[model samples]
Target: MDMKKYEVGESILFDIGQKILEAHWQDLLANTSLRFEKVLDVVTVHQQKQGIQNVRPKNLAPKAQQAYFQTGAGQTQHLITDFFTDSTKIYQQLKALDSILVRNLGPEQIIWPFSNRPQDLLADEPSVPPNEAAQLGVRLVLSDELLTQLFTTETAKQYPSFAAFKNAIYLHLAQNIISNLDILVYFFGAAPIAMPEASGVKRSAIQAKRFLNCNMFQDFDSYLLSLRKAASEPQPKLLQAPLFLRPQKGDLDYRQGVQYLDLQVLDIQPNVADGVFDYQVQFLKLFLLFNVVHTTDPEKLTTAAQRFYQVANEDPTQPSQARPRVTAYLQEMREFATKFFPKTDYQTALDKMTQVVANETQAPTAQLALEFAQSGLFQFGQQLAAKNQRILTGEPYQLRGYTDKSLEIQQFIGSAIELGLNYRFLDGTGEFLQLRSQQQSAIINARITAKNPLILQAILADQQAMNNLLGFAQVAVPKGFVATDLTVAKSLFHAEFEKSGVVIAPQNGPKTAQQVFTTPIDEHTFTTSFLEALDYDDTVVVKAFIPGSVYDFYILDQRILAILEQVPVNVVGDGQSDIESLIDQKNDDDRRGRLGQRPLVTIPKTAATAAFLAQHQQNYQTIPDRGEQVFLSAIADLAAGGDSFDVYEEVDQSYQKLVLRIAQTLNMQQGHVAMIIPNIYAPYQPQPNSAIVTDVAAAVSIIPYSFPFAGNQRKLSQVIIQSLFSNSAKERADD
Candidate 1:
C-alpha cells in the first residue's frame, strides 16, 4: 500500500482527483463546517512558497466566504499543534510536493488559488504569518478544468514520468484532503499518509467524541472504524442516523448561512471494503455496536431506527439485488429522522420533502396544504401557540382515507391547536374538522370549504347550470358549451375558434365546483379525447382558450388578500447546453428534491411537453441563445413543475378592484379567482374580449402566495387568521 509500490495511469489518477474535487463540493454543501479552512490554509502556504504571483482571488459570495472561515481564529491552532513533532525533512518534502503542484499547474489550472485580476490590481502584499493565514482562509475551489490542465502533455512532461505527476498531485490533494477517499484510492495509487496535525482532524476527533456522546472512543476515526466493523458483521443491526456536530463551541456554524442547522443526512460515499480513512466521514445507513442517538431526544431516535429496521427486515436479504427496495428503506429512515428533529428554524427540510412526496402520491388538496406548510404559516401558527400559552401537542399524524399519504389535515389541526382553538372530529370516520374558539366556530369539509347543509344542492348542479349562473351574473368568462357526443364537441370547438380566433378546448377531467381553462388544447384529437385514453367517461366543458398569463387572486370579505402569477414550466437557455441538457441541470438542483419530493417539482418530460415543443418548432435537441426562455408545457400548473410568483404587491390596484368586483358579483366573501391577464402589473384597462374570469374556488390553497417559486414572500396565513377572527360588527361596517 506504500506510494512507490502502487501503479496507476496518469489520466486515471487525474480523473480520481476530479472525483475527489466533486466530492469536496458535495461535502461543502452538505456539512459546511468540515474544517475546509485547513484545506485553504495548506493551499495558500504552498502557493506562496512556490512564488506564484500576479493573481487575485475570486470575490466569493458573502455566504461562501463565511463557509471557508467558519472555524474562526481559535480552531486554527491545530495547524501547528505538533509543529515540533515533525522531522524538518518530512515537512519540507510535503511542502515541496505541494509547491510543485502550484508551479506546474499554475494559476490558470487552480481556480480557487487565483482568478483573473483586474487591470488596476495592486502590487503583492506582504504574506500573513502562518497562524494568521490559517485564520483568514482562502476559497477552496476545484473544477474539471483544473484537473484537465494538470494532465496536459506539456504539464505531464515537467515530471520524469506520468507516475511522478500523478503522485505529486494526489499526494498534494491528500494533504489538503478531499471527501470520499475510497473512490480516490480505487483509481489513484496508495492513499497518502494521514497528516492528523495538518488536517486538524486530530483535535476534531476529540470534540466529535463528546458531541456524538461516544466519549469511549479516542476520536472520530475510531468511532467510524467501530461502525465500519459492525456493518460487516453477521446479524448486524441498523444504527440510528448519525450527526456531524462541528466543534463550534456553543455558537452555530457561520457556514450554515442560517442561524441554525437542521439535522443533515450527508451523502458522503461510505468507505469500500479496502479503503482507509483516519478521520470522520458520513453515510446514509449506520451499523453500530450499541444504541447511539444523534439527537437530544432518544425516543425519536429509537423510533426512526426501529422504522428503518422494519423496512430493512422486510427487504429481500441481499440489498445489492434489491437496489430500489434498499433506496426506499433509506428514504424512509431519512424522512423520519429529518421530520423528528427539533426545529430551531421556521420549517424543517422534511416539510419540503413531504409536499413533494404528497404531490406524487396524494390528492391535489393535500399537496397544496403540505406545500403551504413549508411557508412561514406553519411557524407563525407555532409562534402564535407559544404566545397564547398553548404547547404544540405532537407531530403531524395522517388521517386514513381522507388525507391518506399526506399531512395536510394534520397540519390544519396543528394550526388550529396553535391558534388556541379547540378541535373535535365530527365523526369516527374523521372526514371533517370542527374547530371552535370561545367567540366562534367553523366546520371544514375534506376539501377546505366551510360545510353547508345546502352544499348537496350546489354539488348537484352540473357544468351547464354553473355556466348559466355565471352568465346571469354577467361575468365575462370563456365562451363554450358542454356536449355529450365527441363529434358535436369538436364541431362546436371549431366554430368557436373560427369566430374568436382562439381554439376551444375541453378539460381533461371531471368538472369540479370551479374549473379553469389552464390546460393546453389537445390538438391531437381536438376534443377531451385525451381523457378517453385514461378511460374517463364524464362529459367535459369545452371553453375558448384564453391567451395570456394566469393570475390567481385570493379574496376574503372586502379585502384582496393575495395574488399569484403562475408561469408555465420552462427553462432559460444558458447558450452552451441544449434544451434537454438544460432541463437535466435544472432537475439536478438540490431544491428539486428526489422525484416525488420537493421544495420545487422535478420537471417531467411527457408527451404533452414534447407536443408543446413541436408546436413551437423546437425539441429537446434545440440549443437556444442565452437568456431565451423556452416553454415546455402550455399548462401553468405547479404540480407539473410550473413556477408561481407572489404578485400581490405588483398587481395594479385597478386590477385588484376589478377582481373584488367579480368576487362580490359571485357572492364570494372568501374565494380564489383566476383570470387571464396579459400583464398582471399593468394599469387596468377595459378589454372585455381579452380579459376574462377563468376559475373561482370558494376554498383555495394559500401555497402560491406563501411558498412561491419567485418574488417576495407573502403571509397569507395572517390574512386567513384575520378573516377567521374578524369582528362581525366591524366586517358589516366595512362592507
Candidate 2:
C-alpha cells in the first residue's frame, strides 16, 4: 500500500498534505501512515520549596468571648481517636498494627520541638554524606546508608527548619503530579502535617476546639458561621494542620499539604524507559461528628487515620513489582482497623472482597460459542452485526471470554490487588471484547477495569478498530461515540480459559471503523450523520457512556472558530454627549463588595477610549478618547473571579451583527460586548461586568484561571462587537 495518513493534531514528518493532494501512495497504504505513539515514561517534577508552620502542643490559642468545647461534646471518643492522649490505648493499637506491617519509625518520625532542628544544629552536608554524623543519624532511624537522609536528626527535632524540607517536597509533588492513573498506591517520605482548618494561629486552634460541639440541627449553621468568619480573614493557612488544633480555611485549595509519591511502574515491556514517574497522595482530613460509645471514640479513629496515612506515605521504589511496601500498607490498614475497631474485623472485609470476585456473570454471547463451537460474537462481528443471529432478544448476553486462564487477566491488576470477581456487571463493564486482528501483533495492557465487563463498549471500540484496519472511514457525527475510561477496564478487563473472550475473530472482509464528535451546531445534520455512521456497514457508539469532560476538550476548537466568524463592529454612542462626562456618564451601575462600591472594571464614561474613538468618530463631539463600551454583563458571579450570570446574554443584531454570528456559534449572547480592563500585570482578563456572552457551554465548566496573579490582572478595553444571527441586525438597535 502506497498511501500516507496523519493523526489529527500531529504534524506529518514529511510533506504528506501536498502528497495527499497529489494523491501520492493513496492506494497502497490506504492513507494509513502506520500511525504510532512513542510511549513516554512518566515525567518527574521537582516541587517548589514552601514554608510550614505548625504551632504544636495544642494548648495555644486566643481567648474567645463565648465558651468553646475542646474535649468535644462527649462524642470525641467514638471517632478520629488520638492515641497520644492515652498511653495504654496507643501502645495496644500500635502493637496490633505491627502484626500486619511492622513499622520501625524512630524518634525522628515523631513531632519534635523547634529547639532540636538540624539546620540550626548540624553543619552543612549533602543528603547522602557518609560519616559518623550521618551514620549515627542513619542508625538512629530505620533507613540504611543507601537511603538518602531527608532531614538531619538535629533538623528533624528542632524548630522552623526541622521538617520544612520534607514538607516542601511533598507539597511540590501534590501540586503537579498527574500519574497515569494506573498507580494505586502513592507514598511521600516524611510528610509533615498539612495545615489545620483555621487561620490566624490563635483563632485556628480556637476553631478546632469549637468543632467538637457540632451536631445535626445546630451543626450546619455553626459551620457556615465559622466559614464566614474564616473567609473574612486574608492569609492562607496550611491544610495538614488538624482542625482541632488549627483549621486550614479552604478545603478546596489544593496547594496546602500537597505531597509527592515517587514510584516506578513494574511489568513494562521494555527494559529501560526515558522518564521517572512522580506521584502525589492527598491526605484530605475532614472533621465530622460520629456518635460512638465513650469506650470506642475518635481518639482511636485519629490514631488509625494517621498510622494508615503514614504507612501509605512510605517512599516507593522505581518499579515496585514485589511491592512489599504496598502489602505493608494493606497490612497497616488491617491492623489499624482490627486493633481498635475490631468489630469491623479483618476477615470480614476480606471475605466481602471475595464476593466481588464470585459475582462474575458469564457474557450473554457465550451462548453463541456454545451453539456454534467455532464462532462466538466473532461471526456477527465479522458480518458487521448484519446477521440476525447477532440480534438480542430479552435475555442479555453473559460475556465469557475475559477470564480464560490462558490469557491471565491477573497480570494487569496484580500490583493493585483488584482481583475482580464479583457481579456489578449491569452497572459496570461498558462493553466487552477480545479482538484479535493481525494488523498489529503488539499486545496492549488493560488499564481501565470494569465492575462488570464493558462488553458493549469493548465491542464498539473493537468494531471501530477493525473498521479502521479495513480502511473504511467514519464521518464526524455530533455527540458520537466517545469512550469513558473506567478503572475497571484498565484493572480487570480480563480474559480467562474457562470461558475466554480472548478468541481471535476469523478473517473477514475489509471493514472500516470511525468515531465522530460534535458541538452545539444545528442538531439536524448531526443527528442524521450519527445514525448513518452507526449503520454504515460497521458499528456506531453514541458518545454518552464516555465519562468526564473529555468531550469538552474536542469542541473547544469549534468554539474558537465560532468566535472568529462573528461580524466585527466597533463601540459608539449618542451623537450629542460631552467626551469627558461621557466617560463617567455611560449608563452604568456599581456593586457593593467586601470593599465599598467598586466599578466591576473600567466602565467607560469618557469618549477617548478606542472603542469610543472608532464608533462616534469626529462627528460625535470628536470621539472622546477616555472610556470604552460597556456590556450589561454581571461583574462578579463566576468568571474573572465571579460566578456564571445564568442569564444568557440577550441576542442582538444591528450594530453588533458580527457578535451575533460568533455568539450563536459559541452559543453566546450575540450583542453583549464583554469588555476587558487590563490591570497591566502579568496575566490579563476582561474587567468585571465584562464577560463575552457564552451559552450552555459555560454551564459545564471548570475554573478558567488558577495562577496566583489571576485576580490582579488588568481587563481588555477593546473587543469585537457582532450580530448573533442573519436576520436580527436591523431590529435590535431601534429598540
Candidate 3:
C-alpha cells in the first residue's frame, strides 16, 4: 500500500502497566506514606525471590493469564501486551491484563483510583531513593522498523545511503521527542508529589521529570554511546531517561540501528483500565508525522522541551510562559494532525487536549485531589479503581460528547423526542432535519433545495419589500434613505452629521466594517465605504450611527426565545502577567480556535490590536494594573473575535414584549431581531434618546444565543421544537 494513502502507520507498541498496593484486598491502606516500606518490601521480594514463572499463583485457572510483575518499588507493574496498533486492540489487551490482575490480587490493591498521578501513591510514604521508585508508570514504545520505513519512504530519494537515512530519521525523532516532552508530560505526567521532599523539585501535577531524564543527544552516535556507557560502566543507580533510542544489543558495534523509542512519560490514569486511550494513539501518530516534516534547531528544540516541561508540570491547561516559537510549534502540530488525519476520533482527541489546556480544573489529578482532599488516600484510590472498572465495563458514569455542538444538539433532540414530536433528517448529510406533529411542522436549516419559485423570489428579490413592511408597522429603524450613488451617500452623511453620526452599510446584503463605517464622517471616508458597499449591493443604506450595544433576540412564532449582548473581545489583567501573556491565555481557551466550533473567535495580534495598544500607550510587555480591562479590537461581532453574553434573564421583561411586537410587525415568526440598546441589561431604556433596529435575518447563527459565555444557556432549537408542538396541540384543542 502507498504510504501517502495511509496516514497512520501500523503496529505502534505500548508497554502499559498498573501500579498496585501490596496489601491484601481487605486491608485499607489509608496512608501511602506510612505503607511505602511495606509496599517496597513486597515488590523487592517479588523481584528478587520469585522468578517470573513462580510469581503466578498455582490455584489460578488456566484461562487467567499472569502478566503482573514487581518494579524496583514494591508496587505491582503488569506488563500488558506490546502488540497494540489501535484503540480497540489496546482496550482488549487492557481488559485481559485487568482480568489476570483481578484473579490474582483482586481489585482493591490498585493505588490511583481517579488519577494517573504517582503523588497519590507516595504522598504519605517515606522518601525512597529515586532509582528505587523509577519505572512505576506506563511507557509507550514506538516500533523502530515502522519509523524507519516511514522516514525512508518519505525522503528516500533525497538521501542515498541507508546510514544517512537512518541518521536523519534519528535526528528528526530526537528533535520531535525533545520538543514535545512537555506536552507528553501534560497528557501523561502522574507524579505530582515526591515522598519526603526532594529539594529544588516542587510538588507538581506532572511528575515525569522526577524519574524520566530528559537529556537529549546531539546525534544517533552520541545516543548509542551513552547507552553503551551506561551498560558497561556500573552506575550507582539505573538511568532515569524517560526517552531514549533503545539499541538492539548491549555493545555499540552490534547496534545496527535504533531499536525503538521508549516513551516513559505517560501517566497511567488510575480509572482507565488501559493506561492509554485510542485518541491518544492517534495524536501520537500525528505528532510524530508533524515532527518528521518540520525541522528545527537543536537548541530551540531543547529550550521548547524544557519550557513545556515546566509549563506542563505547573499547569498544562493554561497558556505557558514559553516563547512564541514553542507556542507556534504546538499550534502547527495540532493543525497538521487535524488536517492529515481528518478523523472524528482524532478531532475528538484534539478537542480533549484543548479542553485540558484551557481549563486546569478539568485535569483528572486536580479533580481527584479536590474531591478526595479530606478523604484518606486508600479510600480515594478505592473509589477511583471502582470508577475505572465501571468505565472499562462500558457502564456509563459521566455524560461525554464529541464536542459542545454535539452535546447541545443531543440535548435538543432528546427534549424534542420526549414531547411526542417526530424528528427526521431531511437529507443524508444530517445537517438538515425536520420536526413534525399532527398540526404543525418545522424544518431546520430551511434552505431552497427543491425550490418553490415564490420562496426563492422572496429571498432573492424582496428585501426592499421586507424593509417597507417593517416601516409601515411604525417600527423604529435607522433614520436614513437608501442611496444608489456614492455621491448621494456623501450628501446623506453631511445631512445626518448634526443630528447623529452617519453609518454607511450595504442595503440588501451582509457587509463587514471594511465596507461599513460609523463616523466623524468626511467625504473621502463616505465615498470609500459607499463604493465598497455598492460592490455588494446596488443600493447602500447610509444611516445614523446609533451608539449602543448590539442585542440579538431570537424569535420563535412571535415569542422571544433568547437575548444576547455582544461584547468586543477584551482581557482583564492580573497584576502579574503582561498584556501579551493575558492575550495568549485568553486565546488558549478551548472556545477560541480555528474551527467555528467555538463561540468566541481567537484574538490574533493583528494590526488592529497593535493600533489599540499604541493608542493606550501599551506594548505587549506592558503589565496592566490589577482590574484594568483592555479591549483588543473595536469589532463587536462573534466572527470578529467578540464574545456574547446571555441577557435574557437580566433584561427587563418589557423588552421581550417589545421584541415580540417588532417580530409580529415584520410577520417574522421565525427569525432574529438585532437592535442597538444603550444598556443590554436594560434593553427597553435608551441613553441616546433613540434606539434603532439595525438588521433582521430570517436565518441566524443560533450558536452564540444558545451557548453564550456568560449567563444561562438557552435551548433555542428545543424551544422552536416545543413551540411547534404547542401550536399543534392548540390547533387540536380548537378543533
Candidate 4:
C-alpha cells in the first residue's frame, strides 16, 4: 500500500460535472425497462471490491479484450472513456483515492483532507489537480449475442429515436456513481462544498424550508415526478454541491475565492488494523442507503442519516455507547419502511435482515434470539454472565449450541438469563432447561417455574380452586362453578348464559382462549356436545363472561410487579377506507408480526374476524365512519391477535393494593393473575360485579413488559432477578 502526498485542488467545475454524470446515471437506472433483479445484481456488484475486478477490461478474456478495444464514443459504442487518458491513469487515480484512508483527520466533523494530500500544507494554498477525485472507467465487452439483444430495433421504438435507445444501452456500463459519491461524503473524508453565505444552522433551516415547499413524495423518483405535477411551486435549489477532500488549511483561500464549508480535523482516530473500521463503514453505508431508498421524505431521510452518523461517529472505540442509539434508529427505520414500502420492491430490504443476525443457525429460533438481542433484554443476560463467569451457550450471545429449543423454552432461557440465573440442560437431548443459582434451582420444561416448583401443579390444574381460595380471603374473584361433565356444565351455565354469555374451559390443564367455549344459553348445548364428543372428561370451569378489557398482573415475591392491559385486535376507521383496507394498513406495522417474530402478533383477518364483524352488523368491506374502532376478535389473547399496553402505573394504586392482597391469598412468589375490568385506570371498589378475576397461573411471562408493543417498557426481568437473588442471599445468611 504505497502512498504519496500531493497538493490537491478543489475543482468546482469538475465536481459539478461529476454530480451531473452520477445524476444522469441514477435517472437512467430508475427508468430502465431492464429486469430489477439484474439491476439489483449490478448495484450489489458495485458495492464490492471483487465487483470492481470483474468490470475491468484487462481482467476479461483476450477475446473480450478485443471487443472492448474496438468500442468507440459513438451512438453504437458501449464504453465510457471521455475523462480518462488511459487505463494506467485510471489505476493512478483510484490508487490515489484509496489513500484517503490514510488521512489523519484530528476531529471527525464534516470534512477531511484527501489522504494523498501533504500532511503539512500552508494556510493559503493554491488549487492544483485533485488527488481524491473518484473516477470509474470501463470498456464494455461487446459480444455478438449481447449486441443483438441490446441493440434490437424493436427496443429503439420504445424511445424517441434510435440514438436515445442506444444511449440507454450505453448507460448500463455506467456504475451507480451517485452511491459511490455518497460513500465518499459519508464514509470517506469528502466534505460537501456549501454556498457562499450558507453554513451550519442557517443552511439547515433554509434547506428545511425548501423541503417543506416540495410535495411529500415517497421516494426520489416520486420527488422528481412531483416536480412536474406541481409546476406552480417555485423550484428549490439543491441543498449542497458534492465536493471531495483537497489540500488546504483551516481557512478557505484555496476555494478560488468562493466560500465553502470550513474543514475540521478528525480528532478521534480508529484502529483500522483488523479492517473493523472498513467493515463498519461499509455496513453503515449500505444500511443508510437502504433507508434512503425507501424513506418517504427527503428532509426526514437527511435527518435520520445524519443522526445515525452522529451516533456511529460519536465514540468509535466504545461501540456499546452507540448500541442503544443504533437500536432505537433501526426500530424507527423498520416502522418507516414497513409503513411506506409494505409492497414495494425495496421491502425486501427488511427480509435481508437475516444477514445481520450473524449467528442465526435456525430461522425460527434465531429470529426470536435476534428480537430479544435487539430489545435490550440480552444486555441484562450479557452483563450478568460477565459478572458471574457462567457460560451462556448460544451463538452470538452464547445461550446454546443449537436451535432446537421450543419457542417457549427459548423465551424462558432469555428470561432466566436476564434474571442472572445460569441454566443447564438436564439431559443430552436438551429437552429440559434447569434454571439455578448457588442456593436454589428450578426446572423449566414446557412451563416456566418460580423459586418454588411444588405449588405449580396445584396452581395449573385447578383455576376454580385458586379462585375459591381468593374469594375466601375476601379478594375479588370471578363468580364461577366447576362442572364435572357436559350435564353439569349445561346446568351451571343454562341460566347465566341467557343474560350474559358463559365461558367453559377444561379445569385440569392450562387453558387458552382458543380452547375455551363462549356461548349464549341457547348455544350452550352445541358447546357442551362438542366437548363431550372430544372425550373431555375433566371438570370444566363455567364462569359468566366478564364484559371488559383483560389485564394481567404479574406478582413477583408477593407483590404486583407490573400490570399489562390487553384489548382484542382492532382497527380504527378513516372516512375513506374500508375495514379490510384499514386492517391491511394496521398489519403493516412491523411490531404486529407473527408470533415469535415480533413483540405483538398481527391482527388476523380470518373467518373468525368475518363472523365477529357480522355480529356487529359489519363486514370486511364495511366502511365505518371516521374515528370508529372495529374489533376483529372477541378475546384479548396476544397469540389470537390482541394489543397490550403497560398499565402498571396507569392503574389506580388502590387496585394495585387489592392485587397484592390477591397475590398473598394465592401465596405466589411468581404468578400471573388476569382480571376482566371495565376500566383499570379507575379506582377499585368492592362492588360484587366490578372486576372479575378470570385466570391465575403460577408461571408468569415478563415479555409483555420487557418488550411491550405499546406504552412504557418495564424491566420485569431485572426486578425478578434482583428479588430472587436477594431471597437467596437472605437464606444463605440465615444458614
How do the predictions measure up, each by TM-score? Answer: 0.42, 0.17, 0.43, 0.45
lDDT tens digits, residue span 1-735, model 4? 111111112112112223324443332222211100000000011111111112212211122322111222110112111123222223322222222211211121111111111211111332222222111112222122322333343323344433333322222111122222222222222111112211111111111122222222222233334434445556433222221111134422222111111111111111121111223322322343232233132234354444434432321112223334434544654564444334433334433433333222322222222332453322322232222222211121112312354444545554554343556568766557776664676565533544655765576577666766877877676567776656655655655565566665566543332333344546545464438533553666666666687888888876787789988778898888999999888888755665644556677778868987887799999997899988886677777667888888888887777777877766666778788777776788888766777877765556566666678776564455556557767887999
Distance from true location, Cα of 496 in model 3, Å: 3.6
Per-residue C-alpha lDDT of model 2 across residues 125-156, encoded as one tens digit per residue: 21311111100000001111111232333322
Candidate with better TM-score, 1 vs 3? 3
**1 versus 2: better lDDT goes to:** 1
Candidate structures ordered by lDDT, highest first: 3, 4, 1, 2
lDDT of each: 0.41, 0.22, 0.51, 0.43
Candidate 3 at 407: error in angstroms?
Answer: 8.4
lDDT of 2: 0.22
Give one digit per residue, the lDDT tens place, for model 3 in 326-401.
Answer: 4465577677555444443656767766666566566554554454556644456556555655554341110122
2 versus 3: better TM-score goes to: 3
Q: Pick the candidate with the highest TM-score.
A: 4
RMSD of each: 24.7, 33.5, 20.7, 25.5
lDDT of 1 at 363: 20
Identify the candidate with maximal lDDT: 3
How big is the positional error of residue 30 in model 4, measured in Å on the Cα after superposition?
A: 53
TM-score of 3: 0.43
Colliding pairs, model 1: none
**Runs off by more than 4 Å, candidate 2:** 1-218, 236-429, 432-735
